[model samples]
Target chain A: METVDLKSAGFGSNKVIEWGIRTFGKIVTRLLLQADVVALTIPKYVELLRREYGAQNVLLAPHGSFEDNAVMPSFEQGAGPIKIMTFGKFGTYKRVETLIEAFAQLQAPEHKRPALELVIAGTDSPNAAGYLAQMAQRYAHVPNVRYTGYVSESDVPVIFGESSVVVFPYTSTTGSSGVLHQAGDYGKAAVLPNIGDFAEVIREEGYTGEFFQPNDVDSMAQAIARVIDNPANRKAIGMQNYRAARGLPMEEVVDWYMLHFETLLDEYANRKGKIGLAKA
Target chain B: MQIIEEITPEKLTLRLSGRFDAHETPQVRQKFTEHAPKNALIDLSGVTFLDSAALSTLVQAMKNCRERGGELTLANMPQPVRIIFELTRLDKAFNIVNAPDAP
Candidate 1:
């Protein structure tokens, strides 16, 4: 079997791999305690695995970030089209149906909608496929609604560069989202639900984004309309977000993980020493 | 952790201080068993912090006091302690007073 060392994977690349490895590793480790595993990416995940299924059973494997050659053109001048994008598995938490209803209301003739397009991207969860199918049928007649079932990570910059704003309609209290971080890094003005760490991240940067009550369709519609109607404000906010995101280099985030790991390892070593002394 | 029990004409007050966490639950539970009072009031004015586990203990205590034919009320909650209650939606479940010393 090919070996991987997650710790040595260059910072940005390591984190992406770690996210996946740690998430899956926990599930697999709990099922098969004696399975030999290689290259665990996340330290917290590894720590949890070790606690449940002895430290010797797992290995850390990290890989460098993939290099994609596709080039993206910079945002053009003038009031660009209001292209709103949301990518995620279709689920109750993502609240995609709420966005669809909101967009449908915007497209109503009475609203006098601006030049706007709503793109729903990402693979729909199997359980939510029926819900997604219902949305597709209901919003079939709505103008400027596009759904891309899935988009590869390499093509993300292309999507963001062509779009003016991104929306995260997630409705949850815990768990972190990589999409929120990705949108920040790409400098796309975002509209997100006010909850959990999202509130902390948005509030800290002073970015030009609005928070609406979770699951409130009318509030979401208003926030979306505000971003689409005002181009100058959108660009200003996007730029501020990009600047703020740049400060949190992936290397620094990984350094935090490394420090945590070192602390855990030292504690384990000291505990083992005490046990040995007692036995002696 | 310390629990100072005082009975007033208006309410039965228990003044709690020090850090409250999961491990301290059993001790608090034992104390409640000994000094179980009707119309109990808990003053968390001196509590530095409270976690979800501690909140569970408070909920259990409230239920115990209510079962004895009286109400359980909380008084003088600090900001951090209040936040735990708010986040867990326990604020709606408890009768919280701003100041325990107030008449």
Candidate 2:
């Protein structure tokens, strides 16, 4: 199956889209089911199916994590060259500058810098090209900082798998984090600034991660050090995170959706049968 | 659209009420220009909601006042209105007063 990573809302965009699609899908499915038609989508979208469309007229198919490979072997020990990944339209809100500064501070003279590779992977936001350009110039002298303009979904798993930690330094009040969830599913630790729904996600999942004061460079730097310095702790936290993320897989999600579709389909079939029987 | 104009030696106080959205911002901007005072004080205590457009207008007005060798100050702003300003980081740009006595 082909996957498209719209990469719209950092960590929360996928779920938000799922919610909107499911809600709208349900209404459409219900109408179609009454007309004896069937509909389908992936499992993560089931809640939208059940909540919006009746449980009867939907077919669900599950998929693996965006980075999951059925053929390739998964890593057992989480400790590796620390890969630090971040992506967003560069803005004051994303706090990419904070992450860059934090990473810079973490690099030490003697300690090999924990094999630190920082990737800021996305295009610039409106009127933010100048700001991002300034950042690029500021950090150009720093080693191991890669600024990828834009990346596709197929590249995500490769990108995510390489990383030991994902960082989200948001400054906004209302928003969700999609990067956080994807990182969690991939069993990578995350470092998020305390903002919006980020704290709730990290706290609820009990992931191996740290929350720091937003816009505070020192606090962010400390959080980065905590992850870079402690690999065993990072792996343990990530492993626990993987377990928490298991229930959110595509198959279970699909099955739930199928149940909803069948119910709606049966209702339509029964109604049509009743009409035929009455005519006879 | 409600405008309560107050004149003082230091500033001109215009207390606004009701929705301060895109539609209202034009009226506010026009009124500000028409009055064209040297110093202006805007009280947003009664405003229920203020969108980004409204905030932009306020910023423009402040800039205009500044150019004229005067200042535009906000006074008696309601909690929700204040929150919007804070959210957009415009609290730093505007001198927001919670109470009449406080600047």
Candidate 3:
């Protein structure tokens, strides 16, 4: 959850329920002990949770990208052609149907529209094969749409390299997305909804974030168009994203976690020392 | 980068799209020097960024054009590009104007 979501919950029924639950938990007293430190993927939620729980033992550890930094493949180039792709599992939360519907409705010349390739990449499973079949049938008439049912870990970088833009049409999510970091690693601009930590990731990645209304096809199309139309902005934003990703490489994140671990251990040791002295 | 060129009896106007940086400055410089136009107007509204190298090339082109008793002016500068000029005080040195008069 974003800071606003946690902060905006009113002190009415929701707060009443929360208070009631806290009272019940305190009365029951299953456990009063807390973890030595709390780790959360999204920084905003970490702060809100810390304040709510009145505990400062919280660590903000944003997710890291893949350790392998092999040079990515070249993006679609030259004038008159553009390619937009999305990578992830086929799930209800992804809202990928919105992207397809918008692509079908986009008003452009056949020659030009064909320039826009929509690649929905994911490994098929029992959960989504039926939904994927429906989408394929629905857009059977549309051109330049490629659906790679399953992509291996080795091929993820290659797929990212071939595209100019990555669309994250998520309708709902609990935490930050690794996809944002993955796309950033390739210097690709992400068309994401302005919700939760999506916006924060975009901001941290500088010029790579393009936002649309959640679950709106027209809004997603417009957002994608904004990046496609301006070749220079698109390239510049991609480079900016690359620079941002470089700052938080895998090794750096590991080092940060190690440091946080040390802080926790020291705090624990000091507490033990005080208790021992008190007992004497 | 895309360069939109126009050759009228009076002068030459080149509208540059994308980034005007070191990577593109040479091409831009060549466009200005290949044929010396009496009055040069480079439309920059479409440009998203302009680095110091680009700034230097523009200054050089302006100097050359003036040597021939003409001026090299930039018009329709995007805000981000315009801020570079203002911050460097190049806005005073160069013939920078609104977009309407640029094209």
Candidate 4:
């Protein structure tokens, strides 16, 4: 099985580095295309690979969610600081400054902001080191803003459990989002940009979310406000997400893959036997 | 990290200790590949910390084992190390158990 989550050939401000990345990406893409069957998490990637790279055997393997754990707090029990959390590797495409700014904007009297805490979970992208630190320094005065550095797997439930709403502060997409799947698994309403893979996944996967234009702080603030302001709306979307996550559990996806592999193996054996018979 | 291997007719268990980070992943990968047990149990009780590189190594090893009609089960995980799996939701992908006394 091959994943088509290609690293961007064009990011950062360095021309030489960008060219090198582009070169490496081409090599990796060539190698990936050589696979008997290439599995892509995003449907768009499958189309792109087939159309752009002339890859014939691309398969759309949707990102799978785990079975529902009791770790998530019940929707009714979602009280406290009204935590608006975003979990991902920060900087580059998945920057948090926009979310932080939007969270700050959501605090305005005009928006009738509720008691909220902006929780930034996970560390900086490997290419963008010290990014979270810079963001922290930049928005140091923003009250109730908490930065959780490199959250471990176990802490995920607790962190997600505490959140009132999950936000995706991504400026762009990099394949199907595990964080989005995690948010759905944990039964949290999402607020995200209505663009690229985010739009595609929401449409394909039956995830309901409050969407705002990318990089628009006001739009983001208002979108987030819509959910946090109404418990009923939040619960409805969260419930839908929970159902969607249950619909395609990772175990079922793996079983599907095993079936496909079995077919491939059978065909391979038949081909080998035919070759042997011809030689005889 | 130290990997103590115990191979029985039923399965192969590897008891690991210390930080399972990027630095130690190469050796871990090599050891797992060398053993290539069909039914494998990795006892992570003694593991203090885990990094992304180590996680990737285990994932690749799990896939390789699964391809060979075997499975990888994580056993006796410490809370800290377990959290890493939970955060990535990898705990679901892997068969995890707390059966400490299993022979």
Candidate 5:
């Protein structure tokens, strides 16, 4: 039995590559399902494997970020500007460029608008230099935006603790994101697109966050501005998110997984017993 | 966003077009802060979509206008835009007039 983090979004955009990966994945997944048990983070995929392959071996495990979930320190607003940050690897799918555009359009005189500090932190990948250069050129004139080259795993907690809000502007996805859990763990407010599991995190999980129309920079910025413009609302939302995180303690979630495993094993053994009796 | 502004000491009329969303909201916020008269009117005949962030901005704008002895009103609001207000129950907070005499 093994667990693979299948974060892929369907066949993907490239037809040739998608064809190869899907074919390979299907074959590998079928072979692996022959094993006693397989764990998946996505609920849809768990159901897919169970129904498609008729594999009772598939089981679901909730997404976990392995965070301390201690009381998160409040970010400093200083007397001048509020700090807004987006963490994780910089890639085209993450939509870092669109986030920059949204932040750029938000620039205004300090008094007329809330002063914002945008920290773009994380290692750049897949044309890192080109993307970084484009962002630097476009936001160079704006003094508030800062780019941190690479952030370590140890530093992630500190980074989440220090930001007023987290922005996840991913254009598409097949699976859930750890970033949402990471953000929620710290009780930080997020401004994200209204799609996928994110909507559930906000509406179902009862996290305090705002949703913008998918792929629209203006909608993204508007959500950000709403947070910045109303300090009280943002604070309330953050508090609510923190409370929600406390309610879904990760330790309890892990316990549930263990109990589910016990039940599955019992069911499998019982099924085998019935077959053996029939043969006898 | 094209802002057709009519400003006077008594009132401010801003005819907003295009999407009154995140990217274009700063312009509206700036003008409102600069020329938020006692009687402010936001003509939204051309707005197609309105998100929560923009809704919060409008709420703040209205509060500011009220503080300065002025009122913020929405006129010529499209059905899509009006539905948001009704859903959030902000329709009661702001004066939304569909037509000059539409009852």
Candidate 6:
């Protein structure tokens, strides 16, 4: 089972419902212990599972950068407005209120910078059916906020490529972030919350970015400003991230999985041979 | 890309230089496997860049060496090339020795 942090799933606020969800999660984890190997995307979870549940079969299989054909644009060439974007399923833990509010704050008359655009790309989470629509209505007065509903696979590159900085307006992280990897693949600087799995990914994956305190508009705005105010720093961070992504492409990750499966096969064959000898 | 090889009965050391990327990987893999030495050492003093495809090739070579009851050791890794191994956390998997800096 790939690791999932149930606490971040936002099951419910009710005490009884939270308790029941926790129980269900524990049962699921227990079932996972019976599997041949429980793969965890985050490195910290490998130790956590082994200590908490005494899960011996747990192994760390880190998330890989998605295969992309997006030609990395020269950061120096862009003359358009600095577009700040947050992509992926929104609402629940991945809230965008802080980001939108921060963008509104960043666009205030007092802060002097180039023209800015806020692109909230992608749809709402299943649990958050009308979250984006509600956000669009709530922040209707905020200028230049475009909600590109359901970004197509072909357009994923275009959305990421055009953006100067990618923001993660998450209340909490549920798992290893695919969006972050996408940001790295596209050579875009990230403004992320300095918490939990985000920290772990930075430490283990060598992805450097501007960090803000979760749920704080001023902090988020300041973090975004840090990247926007300086083009050299943005390009440097983006280049470092691109190099990091190039270091661990998905093909290398697949090879690691294949090798692990081969090891498991060898173990199984030995066990089968021992059982056959005992039966004879 | 340049690969200088030194082969002995027990060990094979291949010194790689230039950009060790996808373009150079096939030749490196061929040189590393041709000898099939139990113990191998990859000297990366002259390598300017190490891409993911090259990393995968090294990983395969390491696996092959281990399966033969020996180990593949990395030596004289330059800082930039070494960062790739460190960032990917592959530094912990292979036996890396900080040999004296290349002259």
Chain B TM-score for each model? 0.85, 0.87, 0.92, 0.91, 0.90, 0.93
DockQ for all models: 0.01, 0.01, 0.01, 0.02, 0.01, 0.14
Tens-place lDDT digits, model 5, residues A1-280: 1222222222355768756766787898899988766766554566677678788666554454346457664633445467788987665556577777788778756436766788887765553346666678866877788888788877887677778888887766545667777777776788887876566445434465877886788899899988877777777777766655554456545543554455567768889999999999
- Name the candidate that leads on lDDT: 6
The reply for model 6, stretches above 4 Å from the true place, is A1-8, A68-70, B1-6, B13-58, B63-103
The stretch of ten residues in a row with the least summed lDDT in candidate 4 chain A is A1-10
Q: Give the runs in model 1 whose Cα sits over 4 Å from its true position.
A: A1-80, A108-113, A204-208, A275-280, B1-103
Q: Model 4, clash count?
A: 5
Give me the iRMSD of candidate 5, please: 17.0
- Residue A117 of model 5: what lDDT? 81
Estimate, for each residue in A1-280, the C-alpha lDDT of model 4 and write its tens digit.
Answer: 1222233312635768556766788788889889777777666677677777887666665566865344444876356778999998887778787888888887766766667899999998887899899999999988899998989988988898899899998777766788888888888899989877788887666688999998898899889988998889999889877766755556556664664576567668899999999999
TM-score result, candidate 1: 0.51
Q: Rank the models by TM-score, top first.
A: 6, 4, 5, 3, 1, 2
Descending-lDDT candidate ranking: 6, 4, 5, 3, 1, 2
Candidate 3 chain A, poorest ten consecutive residues by summed lDDT: A3-12
**Given candidate 4, what's the lDDT at residue A218?**
86
TM-score of chain B of 5: 0.90
Q: What is the TM-score of chain A alone in each candidate?
A: 0.66, 0.63, 0.79, 0.91, 0.80, 0.94
Those runs of model 4 whose alpha carbons end farther than 4 Å from true positions after fitting are A1-10, A67-73, A110-112, B1-103
Model 6, B1-103: lDDT tens digits are: 9988888887888888898875578898788668887888889989998765677788888888888999888998999987666544466566788773221
Q: What share of the true interface contacts does candidate 2 keep?
A: 0.00
Q: Model 6, range A23-131, lDDT digits (tens) per residue?
A: 8888989998899877777757777787889887777665777864446655652668889999999888888888989999999988887799999999998977998
lDDT of 3 by residue, B25-76 (tens): 7787787778787789999978987654466567667767877899888998
List the global CA lDDT of all models. 0.63, 0.63, 0.68, 0.77, 0.68, 0.81
The estimated TM-scores of all candidates read: 0.51, 0.49, 0.60, 0.69, 0.62, 0.79
